[model samples]
Target: MKAKPLRRLFIGFLLMAVVSTLSVATPAHCGKCNIHLLTGSEYFYALRDAIDGAKHSIFLAIYLFKTDNHPTNRATGILNALLKAAKRGVETTVIMERSDDPESFINVENEKTGRRLLRAGARVYWDRPDRKLHIKAVVIDHHLIFLGSHNLTHSAMKYNQEMSLMLNDDRIASEIINKISRFPKTPFKRQP
Candidate 1:
């Protein structure tokens, strides 16, 4: 499949992930929330699912949200999912690494990506540029959370091996949200 079409299909899948939220869930035993151990593509898919299904908010604290022009195009792919959720009035916000890797193209493209997200109506925050915020986390609708080592990059999505947890727990999610609220915020600068 061509990269552009694959990208479009990923967009469709993201829309379905949100619109068909029921598919992402199963009956929980006696009110115990569901949790899944996501690895590889499952990890990224689950993140997309949660963001798509979000009714209230999506908060992301990512280490790197880099994009590439490869055929896989995992970089720009995920941004569509994020912007879709934001367009749906999901209150999407991203807190990206402040001190980006000096030698990383991912870091450079991420600033550009942030600009795209801003145009898409999402709030993008850069964590204190003085310090490195090496976290990859997402909180959706105050209940679901994804945390792990996956960067929002093509390698992390399709090529590299990565691990993350998909959880449906409001207690811990709330606590994390409160903690994120205290993190020093750095404004995103639009690339000229």
Candidate 2:
């Protein structure tokens, strides 16, 4: 009868609606990708954990790595993690920003932090003074990457609202490392 056909059509439409909703809720192309969208203070703990767990290597290029003596500052914790990673024999490399003017705040802060890491046995390099290396990126073990606007500073990590992504993609990580490798290792006079 006509009622039976109408019922079947309604059931089919209901099934399609459910299917569409399910597809909309879940992405279809996410196949082996694991990504975390970090916002605000989330970057601090995630980066610290990655550095703490690094077994092979940690390559970091940052615009700023200003560290302070604040006991609970998140950026300080991340800095300590890098130092520990270096001490544990992980091949740690840090490329920092240097300004054309030596007395700039970013220059002074980066130098202080870079020296601290160097004394802890990490290899540190200064980017060309003419070009600003304003990259806040970390490639850990060549398998994980942290890239975004979150600088390694107390204000950026703790107070200011920031966003970053932690992705587990080797190809992207390699590309980032490659880009960082090309940065000129220009030498600058260190403060005694």
Which candidate achieves the best TM-score against the true structure? 2
lDDT of 1 by residue, 1-192 (tens): 599999999999999888668655743332566778888888767777667678999988888898755555765667878889888888988888755444455457678778888888899987876777888888999889888888898788877888888888888788778998789986777433
TM-scores for the candidates: 0.76, 0.81
Residue 184, candidate 2: Cα error in Å is 1.3
Candidate 2 displacement at residue 39 in angstroms? 0.5
TM-score, prediction 2: 0.81
lDDT of each: 0.79, 0.88
List ranges where model 1 is wrong by over 4 Å.
Answer: 1-31, 69-71, 100-106
Model 2 has an lDDT value of 0.88
Tens digit of per-residue lDDT, candidate 2, span 49-73: 9999999999999999989888887
The segments of candidate 2 whose C-alpha lies over 4 angstroms from its true place after superposition are: 1-31, 187-192
User: After TM-score superposition, what is the CA distance of residue 74 in candidate 2 from its true location, in Å?
Assistant: 1.5
